[model samples]
Target: MLKGEKLGAAIEAARIKKGISKAEMARHFGVKPPSVQGWVKYGRISKDMLPRVIRYFANEVGADHWGIEPGDPYAPDNLVQLRPKLSAAEGMVVIDRLSVQAGMGAGKLAEHFPDVIDNLRVSKDWLRRNATFTSMKNLGLVTGLGDSMEPTFSDGDALLVDRGVRDVKVDAVYVLSLNDELYIKRVQRRPDGAWLMISDNPSYEPYVIENGDRDHFQVEGRVVFAWNGRKL
Candidate 1:
């Protein structure tokens, strides 16, 4: 029962599976970049653009295709509907944890680190929260809050961060914030007391944070893993 936009998302995933970029696809179709984005966003490439897309990704269509489901062939709800929001109390805690790690949340605290919990260390247990924290030993989670990290991270996806903390290395992706809005972007420290926040998805522009704004910005933590309701 897939229709309209869901169908378009399936095609987009198929395109990713094939290692093609949207800008490249737009060029292939002799169309504008936004035109291709519209196709991905709405799940419908215009009729004039369909032939070009079909020609480019010809081998991807299912053969003697079986009937499809009502949502995305993969991660259906993410593609087809808005996700349910966590309760304000729950969201507040998650946001608080992120703020704590990144060195700023919403309120001031005399003692930022907690002495109350023995399980709070950044270990397999901290991430897994289970009898056996084996599967998630190397994983961590962070909340995304703004569009500077768009295309790579949406407004609410709980990012799966990894254990690589400490210094900000070149080309390493970090979950950080400036002026209280958190972001996940590739970081490359400059010799001049500034840093570049590079967006992995090329559709967005890259920007830098100056030394003057450094106090308002800090590396909350590095992202080694990501998870959302639709992705793990």
Candidate 2:
């Protein structure tokens, strides 16, 4: 039987065997006293929470007498519980890749031609939820670097860039080729044809493109989705 079917039995038997009161057991698991009582009354545990309940029993009691087995594969892995991805709603898609050595904060990124070395597979639904533009042809993966936008986007993060969005839009993050150096910064359009290139972190001062400075800056693309995880 699935672990859910036997959760109450296992917990009840384990508690009775250990001679522990409901209050003490509730305290150990960080649950309300009524919750523990409910578990005994209703054997069924919440499907999503079952895995954690299963783990707690094994680690604390080391009792195999419980019907539920150890290392339950049904439990969602670390990524599922922790990162909470946007999931492949309709299968997956292959996206163009730009490595750290070429893109990111390493140097001036390609303005005209892209050297597509590899591809990244992601849930198409993730793209659908994030993308504003329709064309997948302009989609490319970029490696993020530095802490200019800490707690927002950070170094070693993965960014999904839409090359089609080369126009400066209000409060949008853009990848730019400035003075032969590639940098990712937020842009705000001013009334006088001037613009402000901002960093989320106040430590890095904002840059102003005073109308005349337009020639020095080029919009490479707009960053759409930022995947904050290790680049594997």
Candidate 3:
């Protein structure tokens, strides 16, 4: 069955071929524009809504486009399984790995807008037991750069970032952008309604953003997990 990015690509291709706008599709499905974007971007949809999605597309672009037998819209074998078996192990989820890197030293400019470079498959049970996230689709992987976050996470570490966190909800490590540059640093809200961007290494001085200068700072996401690549 077509799943993951493949499924997303298929849906996008059919939508484009049919000349259907995302807003129009959302209205047809009784969902918001972002929900349709999620289906096209992450290839995920609720199981209960799968049948409707299949039928809608099948009718719009014809069943031949999706390799479904004619007149058998509900055929089990032709169904597009949203949660496909990612690995040999069952109950696994795929998290997109972004091509962009988050610098832990002096900030770096993103050469290009971030794109999905690959997918990281992890056990659902492990994710539920370890990570505190609202949804699996919001999680992404990025490689860390520089030694500013050493001892906690060295350079070249792989980090799990929650893209859904666009603001500093609590004092924690976050992937943020300052003056158009990207950085991974610990963020703390100051008592005076400002933000303190701190590096773990003492050599680098903390930077503070006052309320007036808040326009230059933007929280990209929250860093939840780090996989250190240090050798023993």
Candidate 4:
């Protein structure tokens, strides 16, 4: 969880300074007033709601107001000038978009570039609660394909991959390279010691195999987050 007392109190004071009532705060986050009221009363924010609250502080009050810094934590080491106005320690995590395409079904092996295409800003507190390794070292971005992980990961969606999670920690979404092509699959360890590669969409059949048969199968990374822009 977050460093509670200080952070909670700080959030309260900042919210008051902004003159946003608990109900308004709830509406801002699209959550119920009870959630905000709970935080105001208890002076604590749960891990789940941390993203929205911290973002409010960062956007409305700025990270400095909350004793935080904004910068990309996952920007590549070789890449200089991560973001303007943000120092390395205090800025949104810079996530570079790679040319690589991870298929939700049969994937394509495309030539990838280390191009810094996008700047992604996330709360430092949120990142710490979710990501173990530094974003720069463990994070990579790719475009998703197919309908296997639909709703969870739609077609042509931008995905945030955490390379630090190279192995299956539990039954979750992970990126894998099969026979040179990359893929994003829902994976789980079967009781028989076999691995089950599943798709969120039940329409697709699961790919199950034993651990010893490591040929052609490679673990690329695990999916931490996803996004899609409906150009209307």
Report the number of the highest-TM-score candidate.
Answer: 3
The digit string of per-residue lDDT tens for model 3 on 47-159 reads 66655565444423544444445355444443433223133256887676666688999788863345444456788998887777758778988988999988788888889
Per-residue lDDT of candidate 4, residues 132-214 (tens digit) = 45355568678898998876778889887787776776777888887667888988998887889899888889988687775
Off by over 4 Å in 1: 1-139, 145-150, 162-166, 191-193, 228-232
Give me the overall lDDT of model 3: 0.74
TM-score of 1: 0.35
Q: In model 2, what is the error at residue 46, expressed in angstroms?
A: 62
User: Across residues 54-79, which tens digit of lDDT does each residue of candidate 1 receive?
Assistant: 33343344311212344433323322
Per-candidate RMSD vs. true structure?
A: 18.0, 19.0, 10.7, 16.0
Better of 1 and 2 by TM-score: 2
lDDT: which candidate is best? 3
Q: In model 2, what are the clashing residue pairs, if there are any?
A: none
How many pairs collide in each candidate, listed in order? 6, 0, 0, 13
* TM-score ranking, best first: 3, 4, 2, 1
lDDT measured at residue 16 in model 3 versus the true structure, 0 to 100: 88
Provide the lowest-lDDT 10-residue window in model 2: 79-88
Comparing 2 with 3 on lDDT, the higher-scoring candidate is 3
- Residue ranges of candidate 4 with Cα displaced over 4 Å: 1-91, 110-114, 129-136, 228-232
